[model samples]
Every structure is written in C-alpha cells, then in structure tokens.
Target chain A: MKTFLILGGGTGGTMVANKMSHHLDPAEWKIIVVDENENHYYQPGFLFIPFGIYSPADVVKPKRDFYPQNVEFVLSKIEMIEPDQNRVKLEKGKRTITYDTLVIATGSRIAPGETPGLLDNGWHKNVFDFYTIEGATALSRFLKFWKGGRLVLNVAEMPIKCPVAPLEFLFLADWFFHERGIRDDVEIIFATPLPGAFTKPRASSILGDMLEGKNIKIEADFNIMEVDHTQKAIRSYDEREIPFDLLVSIPTNMGSEVIERSGMGDELSFVPTDKHTLRSKKWENVWVIGDAGNTPTSKAGSVAHFMLDVIVENILRQMEGLEPLAKFDGHANCFIESGFDKGILIDFNYDVEPLPGKYPLPGFGPFSLLKESAANHWGKMTFRWVYWNMLLKGEEMPFESQMSMAGKWK
Target chain B: MTNPILENVEFDDDGFMIDPNAWTAEIGEAIAAREELPLTDRHWVVINFARQEFDANDEAPTLRRITKTTDVDTKELYKLFPGGPAKKAAMVAGLGKPTGCI
Candidate 1:
C-alpha cells in the first residue's frame, strides 16, 4: 500500500486524514498521521479559561478519539522533512518515513522569546498569555483575586492566530470586571501593532467604537521594542511607553520548528504556498493548510475548514496527473464574541472585507453579519460542539468553500 | 501634509500609497520631506528595501525584518527614520499600509 503521510495531526492534519482516509481505497493507500502530542485541544476554548467559562476538561481530549481507526496515528517529534526525497525523519533516529504525498499542518506557536525581555528571566507574575493551556490556567488563577490596575493586552506583532482574539479578550475583560463589580478598578488597555483595532476599516472602526464604549484605551500602532518589567511598561520601536500592572501579551507567533529545520518556511516560518491553490510554491506534490501556510487571509480555524474541500479536490486531481484547480478564495467566516452574551459575525474572502449582510441563509440568517446579536453569540457557543463533531470529521458544512456576496450591502 | 507632490497621489489615511505602482523616487523624496526627514543615503537604503519587499510579498516588511535582512541595524534605522521606521519607510517607499495577516 502507498503511504499518505501527514505531519502534525492538529486541526488541519486531522481533518485531511478524516476526509482522505475514507475517500482513498484502504487496500491501495495507507494513511499515517504523526504528531508530537497525543492530546487534542479545542484551542478556541482557551479564551474562556481566564474568565472561568471553560475548564481544562472542557477542551482537552485524546487526539486519537477524533481520528478514524483506518488512519495510523504515531506520536513522535518530526526531525526534518526531505521534500526532494519524499520522506520525513523522526527523532530518536527511527527509520525515516517515506510518503507518496505530504500534507503540512504543523500550525503556529507562541514564541515569546522573539521579543527582548519577554522571557529575560522567569516571566512576570503579572505578565500572562492565554494562547497556551498553562498560560490560560495560570491567568485564570491570577484573575481570581486581582484588584487590577492597568491591564494592558498587547499584541507584539501580526499574523497571530485568531487575530480578533486580542480584542475579544479585552471585551470579555470589560464584562468580566463589571461582573466582578470592579470595572472601574480594572483599566483595560489594548496595545496593538496595527494602526487601529482591526485590519480592515469597517471592522476596525466598529471594534474601536466598542473599545471606546467599554472604556478601553487603544494604544494603536504600538510596535513593541522591549518589555520593561522593572518599570512595568512596554517600549515601542518609536519610544512610546505603555505601562501595565497586568500584561496579557499576544507574543510573536511562528510556525513549528520542524518547518524551519526543513528550510521550507518564510522569515516567519510560514510555508510559502500559493494563496489560491493551497499548494506549496516550491513543491508541486506538497500542500499547506491552516496557519502553517502564509495565506493573506486571517489565520483561523474557519479558514482552515473552508480550505478542506479545496485541498482534497486538488490533491485528488494531482494524483490523476491533472493540474490543481485554483479554487480557494481565502474564505474566512468568524464569530466575534463581544461579551455580555453578544457577538458579531463576519463572512468574507480575499476580495471582500467583512461586510454588513446575512450569511448561510442570506437575507434570512438567524445571525447578523458585522452586527452584534444574541443569536451570533449562541452560534459562537455552539461552534465548540460543531468543531469537534462536524468540522474535524470533514463533514459537509452549510457554506461553500468560496465566499459569496449574496446579501452583502455596501 | 500640504505638499504638492503628495496632493495628487492616492494614499490611505496613514499616508501609505494606495497603489504601489504609482510610486516614484521623486514622490518618495517628497514623502520623506513631509515626515520632516530629508532623504539621505541611509534613509533610501531602508526605503529601497521596503519597496523591494512590498513588490515581492504585496506587504511591507517589519522593522525587525528590515534590520535582520539589511546592513542597517535596529538603532541605525531608528536614528535615520526616527519615529516608526518600518511604517514610515513603507509609506515613503510607495507601499500600502501593511495590515499584517488579517
């Protein structure tokens, strides 16, 4: 049987395995998934941990539980990927795994050390990140009794996973502190490298207004030079200083180390993939999905989910010696959780910014696009269930792979 | 803000070029002059690098990236471009305002 090797069995890899496993004839092809960890994390749930909304038990599960029995799951650290030879080397000097095809879903990770003084010593008792389980758990414990001062949530650079999360954190913090009867005591500050609250104009203006409404001061265009723990401030490249009593850092995010070691990634370690086709620019046989590839779209789970059909179709076409179709439109649909049981939905692709419209059921959506609603919040909450059940299984979703502007208004 | 060189140019609110192909070196000089930074050899190095990067990636390179790839180190870039070297350099380079990964 021909080996279909997938590296990093996270969201992308697992979903690919789930689809290709059933589609490819078992007698003709064998699917093997290699991941360092055995546990699968519902990463979006990490956002709720600090507010005591979700516990560790709510998010963590065995990785194998999501994968079908037909797929072989191996738990090991990937040492290198030899693209020329069509093989991958594992740690412990194990026999290299050869493959007829390769899929990279290694995903991105928090590299706080990329910044000066971020991890100079042990991280500050005041400084915390919610990107990791440990960080979220620790922050949850810290936020318990903290009579907060300036709670500065700073994003060090761009291309961070779930780009809207930093704003969501501050919004939730507003609701969180108000619920605790200490809203005024907790001065929330959002420091970002972007010129405004978000990347796009309409979304940024709306989100910026929300921040203003919630009494959160936004220190926009703040590119951090260094973190001064002694002074309790972050210095920008322009020498602007934003001080903080509690610093929630969205640090520099980079792709997996294995990508770097393989000499296959960009300066940020994101694989250079054709933005539309989802195929590697350097290799015809290789495919990149999720945060692993440098796609201009928001690096998000929904984006990955949207890419699934395109990748599967293209890979299959490639196997038949046909050219891969340039089908992916960089479609990304996200539920922006603006606390107090309210959320906003954004549906867009490469050409379209998040516009005001109805989605899925256009002009009759239970959820409103770019407008806050309770229904959208419910959708956001329900996504956790959908993520585990439908999304990972590569099941058919209501929306198509390409974004449509059926009911969008200018 | 009122320079004639900048008057007809299509640019965003942050003063980055809306269409990169519309950029000319003369306009780059005018942009640099508007920022109260006279175009020097040092400044052009950063601007050239930024322009080249924007052409390649359709996005301007970060200050850290500029420093790492070019001969000009971090402090030197700050000294030459002063306030926000990367964005300022991008603006002068006739590149669009970079929205990292939206």
Candidate 2:
C-alpha cells in the first residue's frame, strides 16, 4: 500500500486528507495527518472575538473531529522533513514515519516576539493582538472596563493571514465604541506599512473613503522599527512616532519552524510552491497548500479551498503517471465587514483585479461587489456555517475554482 | 441602461441583460463583442449548454459540470472565455450570477 502523509491538521491538511481519502482506495492507499495541537481554530472568527461577536467555543473544535475514519490522526510535533529519505521525524518520541507522498499544509502563525519591545511592559495589558484566541479574549476583557483613548491598530508587516481582518477589526472597533456611547472619547487610528488602505487600488479607494467617512485616521506608509512600551508609542525606522493608549497589532506572521529546521523553506519559512499546481518547486512528491506555501496571493481560507481542488486533482493525475495540470489561478474572494450591518465583497485572481458590480447574479444580485451592502454583511456571517459544513468536508460547492469576470464591470 | 447589442434591451449595472428571456443570438453576439470575444461554433456549444442548464436549474452551471457533461475540456473552456469560463459563459448566455465558492 502507498502511504500519503500530511503535516499540520489545520484547514488545508484536514481538507486534503478528507478529499484524498474518498478518491484513493483504502485497499491501495493509507493516509496520515500529523500536527502538534489538538484544537482546530476557525481563524476567521478570531477577527470578531475582540468585539464579543463570537465566543471561544464558536471558533474552536478538536482537530480529530474533522478527519475521516480511514485517515490516521497523529498529534505530535514535526521535528523535520527528510525529503531525500522520504521520511519525517517526530519531536515527541523521536520516531520516524515513511511516506510515498507528502503534503505540507502547516499554516502561518503570528510572531509577536519578532518585533522589538512589543512584548515588553504593556504586553497583553494595553498591547494585544486579535490574531490568537488568548490575545483576542484578553482584548475583549480589556475593552469592557477600560475608558477609551487612542486605539491604534497596526500591522507590523505584510502577508498576514486574512489580510482584510485588521480592517474588519478597525471597523468593528468604531462600531463597538459608538455602541458604548464612547465614540467621542476614542480616537481610532490605523497605521500600516502600505501606502493606502489596502494592497489593491480600486478596493483601497472605496475602503479609504469609508474610513474617511468614519473619521478613522490612516497613518499611511508607516514602517515600525520598535514598540516603545514606556512611551506608549510605536517608533518607525524613519523616526516617525505614533502614540497610543491601547494598541491592537498584527505582528509578523511566519510559517512553522519545522519547515525551517528541515531546510525546505524560504527566509520566512514558507515553502516555495508553484503558484499554479501548488506542488513544491524542489520536490516531485511534495506538495504545499494554504498559508504554508509561499504563493503570491492573499492567505485567506477561500484561497486554501481553491488550492485544495487543484492539488487534489493534480495528485490523482500524478499517481496515474500523468503530469499535473496548472489549474489554480490564485482565485480569492473576501467579504470585508464595514460594521453597522454592512460589508463589501471583492473577487479576483492572478490575472484580474476586482471591479464594481453585482455578484453571482448579474442584474439581480442580493450581494454587491466593491460596494458596501447589508447582504454582504450577512454573507460574511453565513460563511462560518459554510466553512464548518461544505468547505471542511471536502464537498463540492456550486462555484468554480477560478475567478469569473462575467458579473463585473471594467 | 440600454445594451448597444440590441435596441431597447436593458442591462443591469454589470451589463448583463435585465431579462434573460430577452436574449437572442444577436444579443449573445453583442455581449461577446463587448467582451472582445469572437464567437465560434465551439463557443455556441458551451453557451447553449449554459442556457439549457440555467433554464432547468435556475442557476448557472459550474465549470466542472460543463466539462463533465460537454465535450469541452477545462483548458478549452478557459480558452473560450479568457479569464473565467463559467462566469463569462454564463454572462454571455444571459444567465443569472453564479452561486457557490468560485
């Protein structure tokens, strides 16, 4: 029997195992998934936790609950991947597992320690992040009793998971403070390394307008050099300073350390993957999926789901002595929550930029594209149900893997 | 707004016909012309399939369903619609916006 081993039992790993289990016959194949943690987080829900929108229970579950019966679930730390030997070493027992094929789905994580003085005096007290459950929970508590002041939301660097999340947090914060009758007491500021509101130009302008309408200040092109906890300020490399009473930051996001120890990753520990096929550029039998792969796309759940479809198809073809098709188009769509029961949706791919229009249904859409609407806000909320049901189950969805331009305008 | 392809034919904000039933061969040609696509017999096959599917299901057909039931392969479907096959083909065929996680 041929053995297929997958690392990281997160969204990508779990979906790949479930899909492959259905296609590869049990008589001819054995599948295994390894991860260091038992809990599976609905990472997207992390954005709402700070505002008491979703509790910790709503966003987390056992990692084993999502796996198939046929797939072996191993809970252990991966020490290294010896690709040349077709084996992996476990950190716990120093045991080894051999495989005919390997899938690297270990996703990215926030590295708060990477920033100088970020974890200093005000760590988790006044300085916090909504990227993790603990950080989000702590932030929720901090916001409950504390009188509002300068609430600065900063992105330490780029390529963070769910790039739109920080924007969501900012919008939600505006709503949260207003609801508490303290909107006047709070001064909301968004400091980012990017020149504008977002990476894409068209969407950025619309979002920037929304920010202006909300009176949220945008500290554009601010590159942070260090967080001075003593001064309650963030100092940039260029000597620019932004003071804050409460700081909610998205620190540097990096890939799993095991990828680095294995010497199979880039400087940031993300595996270099073919943007089309999702196959590891260095190894024939190795594939990278989700945030773990160094693909030039948004590290969002939607991108992972699209990548899984391509990777699964390519793996099946490769097993039959056929070349993998370059089917993935970097297709990604995101619903940006703008608070006040409104949001915007943006869909695009490697070759296309998002444009204004109605989505799914041309002239009669309930959801608007690149413009704020109540329908999109519901779409964002409804996605949690879709994620747990259709997406994680490896079930087929009505949409195609690639992005479509039919309902959009130039 | 009125579509340039057909007189008195209304288009939505996205340029799709307000009434899909109002679509004709000429409308398809005009839509394709606006998209800068030259329609061929091969393009008709996919468009016709999309229309048939939409009539029965009240929704646009996914690319998987199109390639599985029709002679057109995935690569050829992409070639027919340069950016996105299901979305572009559905638009040209006067179908509603696609539903699902494309």
In order of listing, the candidates' clash counts read 0, 3
What is the DockQ score of candidate 2, to 2 decimals?
A: 0.01
lDDT of 2 by residue, B7-66 (tens): 777777766777888888889988888888999999999999988987875667666568
Could you say which candidate leads in DockQ? 1
Q: What C-alpha lDDT values do all the predictions have?
A: 0.88, 0.86
**What is each candidate's DockQ, to 2 decimals?**
0.62, 0.01
Every candidate's fraction of true contacts kept comes to 0.78, 0.00
Per-residue lDDT over A100-144 for candidate 2, one digit per residue giving the tens place of the 0 to 100 score: 989999999888887899999898999999989999999999998
Candidate 1 chain A lDDT trough over 10 residues, lowest sum: A117-126
- Among all candidates shown, the one with the greatest lDDT: 1
RMSD of every candidate to native, in Å, equals: 2.1, 14.7
Model 1 stretches astray by more than 4 angstroms: A121-124, B1-24, B54-59
- What TM-score would you give candidate 2 relative to the actual structure? 0.80
Off by over 4 Å in 2: B1-102
